[model samples]
Target: MKYTEEQLASIRHPRGHSVTFAVAGSGKTQMLVGRVAWLLQQGVAAKHIRLLAFNRSARAQLQDRIRVALPMGAEMPRISTFNSLGHRLCELFEREQQLPRHELSTSEALLKKMARRALVDALAAGNEKGPVSAEMLDDFVAFIGLAKADIEPPDVVLRRLPAGNGRAFFCDAFVRFERNRQERRVRFYDDQVRDPVLLMRAEPATAQRVTNKFDVVIVDEFQDVSRVQLELLVILVGTRAQLNVVGDDSQCIYAWRGARPEFMGRRFDTCFPGATRYTLSRTFRFGHQVSLAAAHLIRHNRHRADTLCISAPSTPNTAISLVKAHNTGQQEAVVEAIAAWCRRNGARRQVAVLARLWAQLMALELALLEHAIPYYKPGPALFDLPELAGLLGYCRLAAGTLFAEPRAREVVRAMLTTPTLFLSANALDNLVEQILSAPEQAGRLIADAAPRKAPNWKREPFYLRAELWRAAQHAWTGKGAADALQVYAVQTGLRKALEGDATDATTEKRLAYETLLHLAQASRATVTEFVAHMDRLRASQRDYQAGSDEILLLTTIHQAKGLEWPCVVLTGLEAGAFPGKRAALEEERRLAYVAMTRGRSQLFLVIPPDAHFQANMEGRPPPLHGKPSVAVSPFLYEACLPASIELGAVLHQCRPEDVGAVRLPAAPASNQALLQRYLRAVASSAESSGAT
Candidate 1:
């Protein structure tokens, strides 16, 4: 594909250390890919080109595009997410430095556990160091320490530290954590980014390896790069590393994840001294009306650069429209109504629902169930389900027993009494506690139980343990019997326990058995590994599902970054709904922005008709008190409402009766079969028409 003059200019220019600022829908990915291709064309070896993506999915996309664009025999450049890049860097640096592998690769929970252990060891040995304070604990718990993406310093930690012991505890833990990591010669995710920056500053050989070794370095999503990331990029490229960075400051929504959009505006000049700037003014996604709506909303943002304030040029699309519902129920009804409309309009397969919260999505699901509509959910809810949690835990346990540990026991106990098997929560918890407290007695009680009991084994602790042991044995042999063993464990009352006096010998025996089972499972499972896997799934499952065209997206606004759909409906847009009662922070602004921009051609923000029912019933003064203004977002008011109403639109007449019916259509003929028949008919008609 031939590049536009602008694209070529950005790629060809030899201006020192310049970065390209790319906006959403401006095709930053395509530009980055083009630059790589251009480098190869200019006699740069593919092996010497490196492409870095901030996230895994983006990395995969970059790799796919490279494969598609490169010649059949051409070598692929090194491509990786930032963490993966750090992993590579650590590996090479370790070989050079002759460092021992570190324990930082352990699960975050385990690492923390070890850190605490180190702290305890230091104190117990009369080291008089590393004391934790209440304030430091507050900070640690707030963000749960820094994410791999968060490269920010420990200022947050430092500020939260209490005097004396608290300060000492934090300092000790941090120092010990670093020492442990250094001793092992392994790098944590944070260390990967941090150490590279250090190496570039102190180690000339390492700096040369990253900088002089590569012919070109192309960075996408430059706006969200953390300070460490920027440092790594600077060291790798320097003034003459042939740098190409592309990002949109307006869309830099990852500040909480340690990204600094302001850095782009400040450092781009110094980093890429005398760099040329190119702007792509046209958007291919939104039509004139929708573009105007977006432009109107974005221009009001005080943080955006003046250049980004101008309206985007129109493209092939339709006007973005607003559909109002008065309350959450009514809003969901509208979502159903819109889904039905899409079916009627022949776009059912292309429709998606974007929500600002899981509760909103639950409202949508309830609406869909009410409408009897068949939809593939495309959000975070799937991974959150208890069943999914159980399955993933099992997978982790199976992947490596060393990772399974306490999780195996916890999940086993929970599954036995969960709704699937119907054991009471109290009964199950008592049994689990007993099993943990006295493993030997728990086993005997389970085996002695004559009743079949709950399939989850809530009745017989010993039986449950035995069953779990069997499952682990089956898993170890790589047999397909693990699921069956789980079923058996539940079926045999091994999952349940009978209610009795505290001193019941049968219960004691059952508890012992369960403990035995737990020990057996733990023998094969790694607590550290399981926790790590679970953590990964917890964070990424939503993103994994969102990319699928198969699942209907049902997610909160905060979850739907970098995703778009051909059809999108935002439901529950009432006073206490869309804006949410507590969304007073900038989170609300970003949530609305994320929800609005997810649409490709059609967008609907539904406000329920009975929005005032609660306030009216509560006898609280009406919203805006007596003025009774509709709670449409101020950002959306002007564009969605007519001009005669002036700047902020007022609540119009309530269309209480317009609460349209939500119908779940009868299952249609198989889409694949129908498509086949339609194609066959088209072919025959065309052939006959030619003869005629």
Candidate 2:
């Protein structure tokens, strides 16, 4: 709870208009709370102080902090999001201005569905060719959302688009979506800000009336605020009100969601030219190496202000590491590293594995579950998805079941429902009984039971599902298990059964299946072993330690932003995977900066060792060259740390006999060159000294 000199200076800023550049792990919330308490002591009324947050979660965090920062029964300050406060402004004069208050449509889940529907309809009507892709739908939705925030009509939005029918297609979708909104008279997220901006601009008296309601405004996470949201604050601060905003420009990774970081780096300073600026660069969360690593990576970005700073050095001496491994071995290596971190610290769980794409996370999830490491995923648990379950069932069914295995029954239940067999459960149960009763001749029993096939099996009187299941069972080991899974997919009408209405969610389901196959190949885990692993996980699902607060967290880098853990691991650090195919290099570099900073004590960057190896990036778009081939990401090189090989080797008492042993690549060898040397030595040493 100790405040640094920089933090204390930022906390006591005399207010007019001010911006605090709180770098990563700089305890932004504490500084903001400290300043608010300072303001209250300076006679600023709590009722007159408006503390705005970027989102509901942040608003709640602020509310919690305020309670702790102030004494019991202290006057509570006004706290809300920018949109909520703006919406209230419009509401204040709704009746006087004859403005109709549209009911806010706040459910993102429902809106995504409706938005997809509108885009599909528009694309179909416009004679657009091709399957309606998730990217196309997302692009259309982003356009509509941005257009509304800019208060631009469909035509204005069209002129701003890149040269393609996408402009027209997106515009068409926007018009259709706006019409739907009008018909329903429901306010979307953008409308909450857009309507108020329009209201205030059209009527200065209304703006003044709203501004008169508050004397001081403090906003957190201002880096992610869009242009319109900034405009609302500018209007409210018009000459009279005091403004104080704290955010990290380096952490501005939400550009895809329409957040404008320019507002944080440049626009805010221009809008309030005389604003008192403070840079709280002393990061209290991490030590020297973490600070230096984040600094090196983030400095490459074109935007972002403030120099990275470290609080104090400590034991476990915070370090950034680069791991070179094969596609399969990478997962295993990460698991071992995490287990070792926990063991060394004598800790339970304060670790996270963050990646840009879900593919990496999915692969790690399997590895973690197999080892029984208690971890919490933020969104949908991939293993719990029906698509995965169905595919798992196919493998389990093909692998066959014995009388003693309870998992076989679960597999049967999943198989029956996932793909309809056009037969009663009793019939399927009898077939399973036959297979179980006659283990050696189960194939013969199935073949005898199957009816003769017509020239066109599709037109056969009997459903071919059972016969297909039998055919899948013929090859049920190793790669053959994965092969059988594909057979089941094709025979079962995978698109019809698993893909629902061609939505993006189904796209994820499809990709998830691909990840499952990847997991199968990497682990070479038998169906029985897979089931047993899952059974152990489920059995301990309610165990106290398993349910304890975030032992191991697996999430995307975007979700990992604004969160910190004692140890953090960033997976898929290969060229295409980390920078990503669609996003800009600078943005991706910023992502790397954000990712590395999340670790308070340790940071590990896991990359596939060779170009031939594909680090699991299934769900995302392929790199332009085709499939992503492994290459050293520039961000990794930016960190300037020695390959962890020497340190690790030293720790295991297996140092390379000489540095000369590292094979220099034909062209400019990197850390991977050193890792190759280390791995070769480790393999040899493990056979003798029993060191891993």
Candidate 3:
């Protein structure tokens, strides 16, 4: 809670303009909040302040902190994510220009669909041409960035054009694409930000209004800001918006999404010539060993430097351990061992197993789940649109019935058998046929399709229709569904359902009602559209689930940003796995840096002895620790400490001294023990039984 000398100095010198380049876990948000609180105490009006974040979740967290830190009824600063702000400004322009709000934000979902079609059409146009390559697809996407919600439209590409003619051809195609978008009533994200800037630039009064309304502007996650985003900020500030920019260039792992950290590093100086720069180099999250490891790993990257202020001598003492598993099974066994160690060491409840890839976490999760571990997985939102809609649909159909209780059952069913959500079209048809033919009765079919519950959830119903809905809705809507319309609907619906009988609401039900309200609000007053919207939502949900390693944390290195766990076991640190044979560019280096930095204290690096070994006759490698050893990640050796430890020899030594040596069966791994504990807790809970 206390700030360092540098942080204190920055706080003491709050002026008209400043830039704070903060690293991840430097309590950037807390500092920002403190700065705001200081200004308010100095009598800055809330109406004249605005806080802009890179994403909604960050904005919400900031807002929550502001409300709690300030006095009751204290004025709240206007907070919004960049996209939201851009969307609003676009609306204002539409009103002023009397034009329909430009449909910008060509969602990647939409563009990918169109791009595939376009690619196919282009291919058909040249039947004699050779087959398309993945590189072609990548180039095509680059020519025109993939569209996302509120993203700018990508420029178009022309096939069969000479290399020299590519630019001109794309420019023309880009213009045509924009014209087509207008004709077709579709908007891309570029239009959302671009139109607003143009409008405000042309209208001094409008720009002045925004600039004047917010006396101080704070932009977090600035390293991810695009040229377009920077322009928007400039308009709001109008050469004097008093700006604060905070982010870590080393953690800019979103270049594929159009982020340019260099722009952030340079633009503040270009925009505000006299702006002072403040750097937060100290990290309070990771232990000294882990931090040093990270610092060493990142220091090798050409884009990163030792002067980034990553060193903090005051950090706790913790060592990074390297574990070599003969195979994934062996790796999982090691994880289980560690989890057990944590529990026995008195921090079972506080430990986490973080992985660079969700696929890499599965073995640990399965081992833990089979063993019944009790732990919470915190990464991002759990239920997605498609999953939420499906759950709600089933809940609606089976409200207060055995079928619809505890919402997740329906999701499990959809995952296994429903074509509308997870199962492939053919697979779904086959499943339906099997079900209809009574190969399995409805009850059995439901059971077969059901997802195995995580041991911890046995006492907690996976499907709390109202609560699930609320969580899903809030995640999507950026707020709780407690507005007038939602409240009225809930009151009226509950009244009808209860037949006017008065009953006390339990905590779960209350949460459920709130979730239901959010879902209802997100449904946009149209059940059909809501259902349709859920497909993408469900797909994304499935993608996220697929990415995770069961109870273990599974996500891409990029996804691991802004998060740190007490214990991190990074699997697949070998050549192909770490750098990823496919990702040889500088971006891959940045991603490696991000992944290496996620550990708080205990760090375990799992390396497979060989890349081509098969653990079983099935010829399939174990799930999480797949085949290993083709190459080691360069960073592993490059970033080694002066007293570097070797895992290869240690693992070999852990094996029996000789094949003939007598040994008792090894105990279950820590992950397995944790899983067992969780399962026992959930299984014994009356709530889980009742829900089921």
In candidate 2, the residue pairs with backbone N, CA or C atoms under 3 Å apart (3 or more residues apart, or in different chains) clash, namely none
Candidate 1 stretches with Cα past 4 Å from truth are 2-5, 98-100, 103-152, 156-187, 202-205, 309-314, 325-332, 378-551, 571-591, 608-692
Candidate 3's error at 627, in angstroms? 15
lDDT tens digits, residues 249-365, model 1? 666666545565556676666666665677544444544344444544455455555433111222335435556554332334466566655766555556677765444454345
- Report the lDDT tens digits of candidate 3 across residue range 199-273: 666666767656655678877787777666776788787755677777777787775455655655555678666
TM-score of each: 0.60, 0.72, 0.59
Q: How many backbone clashes does candidate 3 have?
A: 52
Per-residue lDDT, model 2, residue 673, is 41
Cα RMSD to the true fold for all candidates: 16.4, 11.2, 19.4
Give the number of the best model, judged by lDDT: 2
lDDT of 2 by residue, 306-387 (tens): 4544333222356666566433333678888888888886554688888876655766776666676777777665545555
The true-versus-predicted C-alpha distance at residue 159 of model 2, in Å, is 8.5
Arrange candidates by TM-score, descending. 2, 1, 3
